[model samples]
Target: MRGEELQELTLEELQHLERTLDVGLSRVIERKEQQIMERLNGLEQKGMQLLETNKKLREKVEELAEKQAVTDHPENVFNEDAHSSESGSLDCDDTSDTSLKLG
Candidate 1:
């Protein structure tokens, strides 16, 4: 209000204006608090989502490592049949004209 308008108001009117301002300020503060709380809740949910994603990624990495370990082992690269053939364990008959060559 202008200075001239303030001079025209009685003491009771000024007190009423003060009370109205206080109520309005209280409502404004309450709304701001509510907004802040909502933002915090949203951030918490995002944090949980990120944590879950991180856990899943770690699990996937572990699974891949296990698979790699099995494939990388020399013993697992060849089966029993292949091992026996590679070791020249086959028997040859003397009557046969064919001869076996070992590398």
Candidate 2:
């Protein structure tokens, strides 16, 4: 077929060769499409898994942030109205105010 002795082949032989080539080409295209579909499915599954993992990580991060906020500000841990005496005694310390004034 590559410019090699094409004149020797009769018209019938050329037609047969063309049919064979067409069948082979069709099979090749089918196989290529199958592989592409498999790859696409794999990538889609991986993307879903990553999205789930990201969601879980985001939840964990929010949990940690909430814990950290509570830890950083301890006032939320207690209700002053319920423990008025304890809060009043704690207020006597006033250690949170660390300012110096000279007049």
Candidate 3:
């Protein structure tokens, strides 16, 4: 009933209206909690997406840093003849026998 109708009613009728109002208020509170839960779930999904993005970015940064390190290395100053040999030994092949002969 309308407020003016309820104002004309007995005290018991007003109390019954107040009870229904309280129940409706509780329903509104429950609906708000559901809305909040859904929003929180969405936020968690976004947080996971952000974490994945962060991981990929870190990997890209590491790749860039490695590329930078390689570029920063000093240029090879040694002659081609020096580096072409299969042996990592700095001396000429003849020098191996020379050392043996001296010994």
Q: Give the top-scoring candidate (TM-score).
A: 2
- The residue ranges of model 2 lying beyond 4 angstroms of the native Cα positions read 1-3, 78-103
Model 2 lDDT tens row, 1-103: 4547878889999999889888988999999999999999999999999999999999999999999979976755756575677445544445656665456
lDDT of 3 by residue, 1-103 (tens): 3466554778898898989988988999999999999999999999999999999999999999877866764332347665756776664456333332222
Best by lDDT: 2
lDDT of 1 at 27: 95
Worst 10 residues of 3 by lDDT: 94-103
Residue 46 local lDDT, model 2: 100
Instruction: Please write out the lDDT profile of model 1 over residues 6-60, one tens digit for every residue.
Output: 7778999999988888898899999999999999999999999999999999999
Instruction: Name the candidate, 2 or 3, with the larger TM-score value.
Output: 2
lDDT of each: 0.79, 0.83, 0.78
| Per-model TM values vs. the true structure | 0.62, 0.71, 0.61
Evaluate residue 74 in candidate 3 and report its C-alpha lDDT on the 0 to 100 scale.
Answer: 38
